[model samples]
Every structure is written in structure tokens, then in C-alpha cells.
Target: MSAQESCLSLIKYFLFVFNLFFFVLGSLIFCFGIWILIDKTSFVSFVGLSFLPLQIWSKVLAVSGILTMGLALLGCVGALKELRCLLSLYFGMLLLLFATQITLGILISTQRVRVERSVQDIVKKTIQNYHADPEDTVAEESWDYVQFQLRCCGWHSPQDWFQVLILRGNESEAHRVPCSCYNSSSANDSAVFDKMIFPQLSRLSPLARPGPSTDLCVVSAKSHIYREGCAQSLQKWLHNNLISIVGVCLGISLFELGFMTLSIFLCRNLDYVYDRLARYR
Candidate 1:
């Protein structure tokens, strides 16, 4: 092959590799989104749904993934087949995707405070209604998981558990302050936090029974439960992962830009007669 032909071949293969990476990345994102949408564990609900559009990050990720994969497929096909029309379509779609990303970045940067406040508000609300029924609601299971994993209680403090009616003076599920509040080793042993099973309970004496033992018991729990809130933890997590996030964004931007340039070059320089004859032979 001539020098020009060799160079064109290199560019074509490079684009193939590029689109392949995007295709894989897009597939992962799409799968993750579907998992979040269908997930019954509610593990993600503890982070609070607010600030972002649609109130669900999973859906957003899923849609973005689909778009990325679709455009990437076009790019792969265009480069491999050396089709000017497909290349043009790929370029246009990439441009649109790039613009959308830029707009989203700007919006997030400008409304940082609102987003933070929204997170705080949502977390607080979830805590107020918090329940530890993992088998039941997603919110409850998620909260239990978070508290257990983080070794923390409540949104801002352990006292947040009191906000729940059943945990308080209510006769329903009394004397229990979520198994998550306890350390993992002792979490399953109900003997630790059991308030109503006092030795005097068998006596049935009013003096021995005492009054609202849960109120004082939960107060002592403040010592064992997590002191930090999920909002604060989430903030730290974002800060810690900021570098990776920025790197991914920059990488995607550069990839799209390269795809656009390469597609344009191939379109402008392609020899229609030679390409047609080569295909037949």
C-alpha cells in the first residue's frame, strides 16, 4: 500500500478502537441504570432524590448510556465501511451529545448551592420517616444498609430515630433502635438493646416496669450509633471522587472531538470510484 493508503488504514483502525471503548462504556452505564431502576433493595434511595432532573440518577445514566452506544455504533460502522453519509450522521450526533454535556456541566456548576441544600433536605426527610424493615420498603432497607455500612445513625445524629413513632413510646415495635445502630458483631444479638425484657417484667409490678424505658435507652444509644449524617458523608465521597469524575469527562470530550475530526477528514478525502471498485474485487 502507498503511504497515503497506510495512513488512512491507521486512522480507520484507530477510530474502530475508539468507538469500541465507547461501546463498552455505554453498555456498562446502560446496565447500571437498568439495575438501579429495577433494584428492590433501595440501597441508592438513602442518598436522597433531589436537585437533578427526573429525581433519579439511574434513569439519566441509562439514557446517556443508550445515546452513547447508539452514536458509537454509527461511528464504528462509518469508519469500517468508509461511508460518507454514515460518518456525517455520526458527527452530527456526537456534536449534539457534546453540547448536552457542556450544558449539564454549566448548570451543575452554577447551581451548586441549590443542589447541596436539596440533598440535605431530602436526607432529612428520609430520616424522619426512617424504618428498619429491610424486607418491606426500599427506603427502610436502604436506611438500614447505610446506617450499618457507615456505622452511623440518623441523618445528622442518633436522635433522629426518635422521630419515628414506632421507636418512641408507641406500643407497636417498642424498645428497638434499628439493628444497624449496633456494631456488626453484636448487631444480630437482640439482647443488647432489648428494653422491655427486664428481669422485673415477670413480676408485673408497676414500680418494676418503670416508665418509657425506650426514651432513656435510646439516649444511651447515641454513644454507639453513628454521629455523622449521610449528607456529610456523601459530600466527602463526591469530593474524594472528583478527580476520577473529571478525568472521565475530559476523556469522553476528547474522544468525541477526535471522532468528529477523523470522520470529516475521511469524508473529504475519500475516492468514491476506488472505494466502490475495491469492494467488488
Candidate 2:
């Protein structure tokens, strides 16, 4: 192969590699979206239709993933076949994808505060109704997972549960606290106490039971239950991971820009390669 032919071949290989990365990334995103949709154990399932935004976002991810894979195939064929029309279409799609990402980034930056507030409101309301209906096993189990994983009780504090119990005026549920609030080192211990029996048992004696000190259990449990709410924890997490998040976005944007430049260059030089091959024939 001549110098020009070799350069074109290298560019074609780069395009294939770049698109292949996107194909894999898109597939992973698509699979995650599918899991989010079908996984009944997740918090998303609890809210059902009320959580329309998340559901819609998941659908978008799945569709975008499929489109990305298709684009990868188009790019591969164009590079290999040296087809002008296919290359043009691939370039156009890349431009569209770039624009969409930039617009999404801008919108997120501008509306971040509003988005955060809305999320917090949703979280508060969800916690308030953590166990509103006994039939809602989905929501209840979801909350249980959150509390156990985050080591948190209610929205702001355990007092949130107290307020709800007062408003509910249900004697049976009065002293009930989520098993996740327990200080036990083992999850099994907490699981065992998740039932409503603890409150009744405490009422029976209300004194130290020697073995684990039942009277002190509430205090210890409160100690284990995170004092900061989920919203607050989320805020801290975002702050801490801001650098990583920005880096990932920047990497994606740069990756797209690089491929776009390569595609344009290839389109310009495609004819030269074809002419050289024609002469060889």
C-alpha cells in the first residue's frame, strides 16, 4: 500500500475502534435501563406511575443505546466500503449526538438547584408514606433497603417517624421503629426486629433485660441510625464526586469531538483512496 493508502487504513481502524467503544457503552446503558424497568425490588417500582420521569429517562437510555449500536454498524460499513453516502450519514448522526449532549449539559447546569429541590421534596414525601399502606410491599421493601444500606431512618431524623405515628394515631404502630434502625452489627439481627413485636415487647418490661440491655437498645439504635437525612447525604455525595462526574462528561465530549474530526477528514480523503485502488486494478 502507498503512504496515502496506509494513512486511510489507519484512520478507518481508528473509526472502527471509536465506534466499537460507543457500541459497548451503549449496550451497557441499555441493559441497565432494562434492569431498572423490570427489577421489582428497586425503589423505582414502588412509586409506579407517579415516578414517570425516571421511567421515561430509562426508556430514553435504552433507545439511545440501540441507536448507538446501529450507528457503530453504519460507521464500520462506511469505513470498510469507502461509501460516500454512508460516511455522510455517519457524520450527520455524530453531529446530532454532539449537539444533544451539549444541550443536556447546559440544561443540567442551569436547572441544578431546581432539580435538587424537587428530588428532596419527593424523598420527604416518600419517607412520610414509607408504610402508609400495608399492601404496598414494594414501597416498604424499597425503604427498608434504603435505610439498611444508608443507615438512615426517616427523612431528616428518627423523629420523622414519631410525627407520622402521632398523626396516624395507631396504637399498634405507636412504638414501632424500622428494624433498619437497630444497632446490631449483623443484618440478620435487624431483620429479626423488623416486625412490630419489638415495640410491644418494650412496653411489657421497659427495663434493661440484662443480655443486650433492652432499655438501652433504643439509644443504641438511634446512634446507629444516621443523623443526617438521605437528601443531605445525597448532597454530600454529589459534592464529593463532582470531580469524577465532570471528568467523565469531559471525556465523553472529547471522545465525540475526536471521532467527528476523523470522520470529516476521512470523507475528504475517501476519493483519493478509491482512485488509487482503481489505478491498481
Candidate 3:
């Protein structure tokens, strides 16, 4: 084949491979959205506690994934078959997707503070209602599960629970902290501001047996409790994963841009290729 033919062939195959990747990514994202929507676990409810828009986000993911997969199928078929009409369609869809991404990025950046405040308010409300129950209501149960999973206390610290009914000497679940906050291990657990739990942590009294779901514990020392707050733990985790997160975003952006470029190049050259073939015919 001529040099021009070879270049065209390379573009076609590269686009096919890239669209295959897009199909896989889109399928995975679509499945994740479905999982979040149908989730019966404490995880989604726990997330819902702080972010009320979690459901909307899931829907967006589903729609975005569908659009991506659809576009990828179009791209793959167009590149492989060298169909100008399909290539044109693929290019237009990619342009639309790129514009939507830019719009979303701008909106998120501009409204970030408001979003953060909303999340903070919701988290505070959730903290105020947390009873460390695994079967109480969805919100309460989610908070308990998050504490257990993250191995952290309240939103900011253990003191964030001091305003609860039990803390004010009213009849409630626990007096000091939720049982979820009680560390099961006896290692170097206490931070400078952490509330430690007593090694002999148990039910409020010997006569009081552990309930089927919730545990009321009498904490004497703050050392046995998870001193760090969930907020701090999450922040640290995000910080640790920031590089990977940014890298993924950049990679995705580059891939999409390349797809657009490849489609445009193929669309512009197909006319010439057909003209040459016509002369030979």
C-alpha cells in the first residue's frame, strides 16, 4: 500500500481500539450506576446522608455511560467500514460530549463552595441523629456502618456527638460514644486530640446485656475510641489518591480528544480515497 493508505489504515485501527476501550469503560460505569441505584447496603445510604444528590449523580453516570457506549459503537463501526455518514455522526456526538464535559467542569468549579456547604450541613444533621444503630432507620444505620467501615468517629471528631440526647444525660443509646467508635484493637490508637476508650469497655453495666443490634458502652478512657473523625480520614484518603484521580481524568480527556481528531481526519480523507478508487475503476 501507498504511504497515504498506510496512514489511513493506522488511524482506522487506532480508532477501533480506542472505541473498544470506551465501550468497556462505559459499560463498567453504567453497571456502577445501576449498582448504586439498587444498592441495599449501608454504603449508599451513608453517602446519601451527606450528599442528597447521590441518586441524581447515579442517573447522570448511567446516561453518560450509555451515551459513551453508543458513541463508541458508532465510532468503531464507522472506522472499520470507512462510512463517511457514520464518521460524521461520531464526530458530532464527540463534539457534543466534549462541550457537555466542559460545561459540567465549569459548573462544578463555580458552585463548589455552595456544594461544600450543603454537604457540611447534611453531615452535621446526620451526626446529630446518629444513634449507632445498624437496623434503626436508613440514615442512622448508615452512619453506624460508616463508622465501622472507616474506623472513625463523628464527622469532625468524637466531640461532634456530644450534643446527642444521650450526651445530655437523656435516655439514649450510649453515654460517651457509639460502640462503633470503640476500637477493637489495643495498639497505638490515640492521636493528640483523640478520645481514648477504656480497655475494659463493655455494656453500661454487668446486668445490662448486649442488645440484638445496638450496644450501649460505658467508656472511661478516650484512648480506646477512634479519635480521628471520618472527615479527616476521608480527606487523608483523597489526598493520598489525588495523583491517581487526576491522572485518570487527564487520560480520559486525552483519549476523547484523540478520538475526535482521528474521526475528523478520516472524514476529510475518505473523499480523496474514493476519488482515487474511482479513477482506477
Winner by lDDT = 3
| Candidate with the larger TM-score of 1 and 2 | 2
Q: Return the candidate ranking by TM-score, descending.
A: 2, 3, 1
For model 1 the local lDDT of residue 212 reads 27
* Cα lDDT listed for each candidate: 0.65, 0.65, 0.71
Task: Tell me the spans in candidate 2 whose CA falls farther than 4 Å from its real position.
Answer: 21-65, 131-147, 163-188, 192-224, 275-281
TM-score of 2: 0.65
**Candidate 1 C-alpha lDDT tens digits along 140-225:** 54566566566676767666676676566555533446555665354455554344123313222334443422222232353344
Q: What would the TM-scores of all predictions be?
A: 0.63, 0.65, 0.64
Report the Cα lDDT for candidate 2.
0.65
- Number of clashes found in candidate 1: 2
Evaluate model 1: give its lDDT: 0.65
Off by over 4 Å in 3: 24-68, 106-111, 129-150, 164-180, 186-223
RMSD of each: 10.7, 10.1, 8.4
**In each prediction, how many residue pairs overlap at the backbone (N, C-alpha, C within less than 3 A)?**
2, 0, 9
lDDT for model 3:
0.71
